[model samples]
Target: MQTTETLFETFKNVLALSNKNNDPSISSERIAEIRKELDSRILPETPLAELGLDSMTMTWIIVKLEEELDVDASGISIFEIFDVQGLMDELIQLRD
Candidate 1:
């Protein structure tokens, strides 16, 4: 099992790449805010919605995960995942 810190970093890195040059609406300040939310002490039960991620951001995240992690996120529904831990769990499963 991946450590919580590692998972957090993984998500953070992917999120940065996902937002890097693709969307103009996700301003630097917005990214910073999102990072700050990720940097917080997130527990397994923490809801993803609390992080201020919308559908578009989630879509970018899925795309980046597929491109960078070599995992197929096409079958995953952004709305189906309710928590940070669930998201990480899904990613790890896909990787395996």
Candidate 2:
């Protein structure tokens, strides 16, 4: 029984491997800003994942979120979830 928390952590570690952890720094405030940006720019059900997100897209999203949120944005596997709330919940857990 893998919990969502565990899945979120996995996402974080993967993001960290690429040096994209919370703005690529350790500033807590910056992380919150990043979350806001994501919320504003990236709609809950944005098809970023399904819109032909190849390796480059994945890398891009990974880098951008990591650079902004300071929290790990590697969880959720956005394409896998059935709805936006599910995806948000996963990311939120990672943020927490």
Task: Name the top lDDT candidate.
Answer: 1
Off by more than 4 A, model 1: 1-5, 16-37
Stretches of model 2 off by over 4 angstroms after superposition: 1-43, 46-49, 74-86
lDDT of 1 by residue, 22-66 (tens): 676777777777677656655668888876666777788778767
Model 2 per-residue lDDT tens digits across residues 1-96: 235545444443343333332235656565555445443454435554433335654556555555544667665465566543465475566667
Model 1 clash pairs are none
Candidate 2 residue-pair clash tally: 3
